[model samples]
Target: MQKRAVSGVGLGLRSVHYDHVLSRRPAVPWFEVISENFMGPRGGSGGRPLEVLAKVRREYPVALHGVSLSIGSTDPLDFDYLKKLESLASVIEPWIVTDHLCWTGAHGKNLHDLLPLPYTEEAARHVAGRIEKVQDAIGRSIAIENVSSYLSYKHDEMAEWEFIARIVKTTGCGVLLDVNNIHVSAINHGFDGEEYLAGIPVAAVRQMHLAGYSEENGFLIDTHDHPVSDPVWKLYAAAVRRFGAVPTLIEWDEHIPSFARLQKEAAKAKEVQDGVCAAAV
Candidate 1:
């Protein structure tokens, strides 16, 4: 599959904005849709969602962001889900296909959450092999995202960032660096967000995510409902300084906002990207 360049700030394509996007053709550089939303018993074919998606595709580049790859799971690879994913990718011709680095299920049962993995050499080797196979199954290299964690394993041999860097290094896959997740995990786990960013290989960073987080009893949660927080914007600046102007997305999932509101958030990101790129020059 040929690579489609997806740069600039974008928004998570939600159903509420379908009319606005199709009618107004809002000036979004690209939009990413949850791969599962468009997949079903039909195997990535049919449905009004697709008709709308196809229409949107004619205007802007699209990316398939998945939540259930479970790349780190001990269960055997889910070829069925992968086939559906491949089918969806073929239909959408997305610029990028990405899922989280954390495992979503184990023992053939999905917990429906981004579960943390042990940061061990053995685990890193385990995930790298799965990523290589996934690339083969989909016939296109995909990026793995860093998910926020509320807990850590006592047996972890290295930091979360180190584990991620090793997987990309071994599989030659790209990284979808989520700036909000880093800050949330940092505050929740007591790690330095900057150090995490520094550990990731710069050139492998294919995309970036900015989102709002919530707090519950002193623990930070990776909820995408609110506006992007102050610290996340600061972390994003640091990311742009290191990774250059990589493609970015503002994710507002729970509390759906107006299309114009999403545009403003994306505009802020563009503004930040511009500032960082100019200062680096």
Candidate 2:
């Protein structure tokens, strides 16, 4: 099998290492930014962080990953939020814009958490419609990522894979295919990981996410605070085999290590992806 070309690995862009990244312009292929971070200039742009992002964006490919958006929410779409997103997108010229498939809140309240939506036809229509609106506002296609959850709904009308498949199919949105999330949700919901991999339409997956998690009280929390665990690595290997070498990223939000350490994690993901392509070939 021909080895797939492994797209380079990157870290989530955080404020802590802005100076280091801008100064060094490290060897990572790209950086994934949280959309809300650079949306507005609360303290004005003369400061260091904005300057650093601007410099880094010029030097490296940047992708915007949002936690908010609440795509699956029952509330009305926030046009103002979409405006902010569009402004940021214009500034960074990100390679892609993406967020969780789950809703953060309903009504006006910001729950500040990625809460799962029931796997139902209603949710499929609701979320997909919002995604379509977002894409329209932003004038481009965006990716939706699978989120880890500790619970499932009793009123679910379909399997998680089926729900996601339909959403992407209907909205023409890309899939992020977070491997660690697949492993986490599979463990929580007692589903087969391989089946989940096989279920997703491979062509719709434009990118991938690999991160660390912790088991607490019989549940997996996406801490992203440590190294990628062995099981998650195996799962990621399976994903690379299925999806070929897509843009993969290593996320470490809390207790982030030094820039060199994060680069090591990205290197590991690249190595595994290369191995999969080699084996498949």
Candidate 3:
């Protein structure tokens, strides 16, 4: 049997320079689209993004990266939100669909952020149950990502990696291992990044996210608003060494750079991945 194609370094699909992407059509292995942006028919500004996405989907394989799954919330699973996701998946036919493991909001209020979940058995069970229901509803497996957190929950009973491993075991879901986020959390919480990477089940990882961050008051934030930092690059190098070049992405949500600049970042990831592949030989 032939080996399955995995995702390599790619960019987050943005509305800016949509034509440039289609025209130049750079050597992107796979593209990741924000799930909510393309979920439905557009009326005003919203529709154009989906139109471009449809064209891009025809050109390259796309993955779904969601911001608002709210997997950790105690509230009932939002079937309406998930049905929309299912509908969009049918249209775009993504390579993978994933969301953060943390909750976004509760009681119908949009917090507009990825809030960390308490690392306890209770939180694990709650998130795992939700992930199962979501996979069942979408008729596809989903990957969960570890978000960069500032503060740790005092009430939590376990480490982040332990919680993540348990969630994967219970739900049988894959992981979108963000190397940058792990580094950020490790630096903020004072843990070994290598240990965090080693604790994860390598076979469970389907994709990886590498992005830049900002520091404030001796804490690292997953800003995704700047270029890839040297520390993150070091971590990325380590990740490919450990995980064998899992599909990686360069995410820049703010201070958006030109497509050429983003592709440069992709090349960096490719360089590291190639170095790893070479070392194994």
Candidate 4:
């Protein structure tokens, strides 16, 4: 499939805002859709959701973000899932296809979580091999996103950033830098967020995710339920400075507000990006 360039600020295309987005045609430069939601029946085209997605695609660029690739799982890769994903990509023609770097489940059971992976060379190699297989199946490069974590592995051999960089280097996949996840992981693990950013290869970064997190019992949670916090906004500025106008998306999956509220958040991102670019001159 051909790649498209997604510029400016974008919004996650939630069902709640379908009417508003399709009718009003908001100022969003692009929209990202969850891949699994549009996978229709076997040997068939996507259903109503895909129809709506096509409408949105007509007005803005779209990117496919997935949650269940299970790239880090021990089980054999799911060719069925990959086939569906490829079919969706063939239709959407997204700028990029992306999923979390962490695994979802194994043993034929869907864990329904973006579980962390061991930051070891062996683990990196294993996941990189899986990523390559995924890219080959999809017929294009896919970006792997860093996920937030509340725990660390005892057998980890390197820092999270190092592991991610090594995977990108080995597999030639792009990085979807989620600034909120970096901040949440940094706060939970007591690491410097800027240092994490510094360790990553900036050129591999293809897109960015900006979302809000909640604090509970002195621990931060990657709950995409609220507005972008001030600290996340600041980190996003740093990301824009480093990545130079990468496509950024506002992800509010839980307690989703009205379309206008989400558009306001996208506007805020554009404002911050504009300020950062202007100051660089």
Candidate topping TM-score: 1
Q: What C-alpha lDDT do the candidate models reach, one value each?
A: 0.92, 0.86, 0.87, 0.91
lDDT of each residue in 96-134, candidate 1, tens digit only: 999999898898799989999999999999999999999
Per-prediction TM-score, please? 0.97, 0.94, 0.94, 0.96
Q: Please provide, for model 2 over 121-190, each residue's C-alpha lDDT reduced to its tens digit, 9 standing for 90 to 100.
A: 8889989889999999989899999998889999999888899899988999999999888888988889
Q: Which stretches of candidate 1 lie over 4 Å from their true place?
A: 1-4, 42-46
How many angstroms is residue 106 displaced in model 3 relative to the true structure, after the best TM-score fit? 1.7
So what's the TM-score on candidate 1? 0.97
Write one digit per residue (lDDT tens) for candidate 4, span 70-120: 899999998988999998888888988999988899888989899999899
RMSD of 4: 1.7
lDDT of 1 at 200: 97
Considering only N, C-alpha and C atoms within 3 Å, which residue pairs clash in candidate 4? Answer: none
* Model 1 lDDT at residue 42: 44
Q: Name the runs in model 4 displaced over 4 angstroms.
A: 1-4, 40-45
Ranking by lDDT: 1, 4, 3, 2
Q: 1-281 in candidate 3: lDDT tens per residue?
A: 11236567888888786878899898888788788877654433337777788888887888899998999987788888888888788877788999998989888787979998999998998898889999999999999999998889889898899999999999899999998999999999888888888888888988899999999888898989988889888888887887888888999988889988999999998999998889889
